[model samples]
Target: MRPQRRKTMGSMKKASVLLLLFLSLLLIASEEMVAVEGRTCESASSRFKGTCVRSSNCASVCQGEGFPDGRCEGLRRRCMCRKPC
Candidate 1:
């Protein structure tokens, strides 16, 4: 009975160590992803016509203008294009 209890305790310790190792790996992976994420820069859309009303419309127009993303921003509601810098 004592030998069986010792075996169980040894397995439990191994399991706990494995769990900690897995969690540390996950944390490191998340940090790498965050580091890979870069800053985005924005500029006024050159091809967008008229006042920007909907962000979806602005995005489409900005795409046509060769930008990755767009949005209606600022007090004037101008279509602003965005791309990673």
Candidate 2:
């Protein structure tokens, strides 16, 4: 029983160490994924319903309008669709 307990403890320790190492590597890799700089073109959503209240909502409608990205902007709060050049 003592030998079996020691083996289980050792296995748990190894698993813990491996998991920590994996998480550390994942954190480092995720940090390397920041957005790249580029030129973007914008246009108002011609088919959007009502006013653009949220940028995310505007983006969703813009995607259906066949653009890559979108945002609510300016004094009128229009949905400005965006695409990279």
Please list the residue runs of candidate 2 whose C-alpha ends up more than 4 Å from where it truly belongs after superposition: 1-36
lDDT of each residue in 33-70, candidate 2, tens digit only: 66788999998898787888999999999999999889
Candidate 1 local lDDT, 2-83, one digit each (tens): 7898899999999999999999999988784435778999999999999999999999998998999999999999999999
lDDT of 1: 0.93
The numbered model that scores best in TM-score is 1
- Give the worst 10-residue stretch by lDDT in candidate 2: 28-37
lDDT for each of the candidates? 0.93, 0.90
Q: What TM-score does each of the candidates earn?
A: 0.59, 0.56
* Native-referenced Cα lDDT, model 2: 0.90
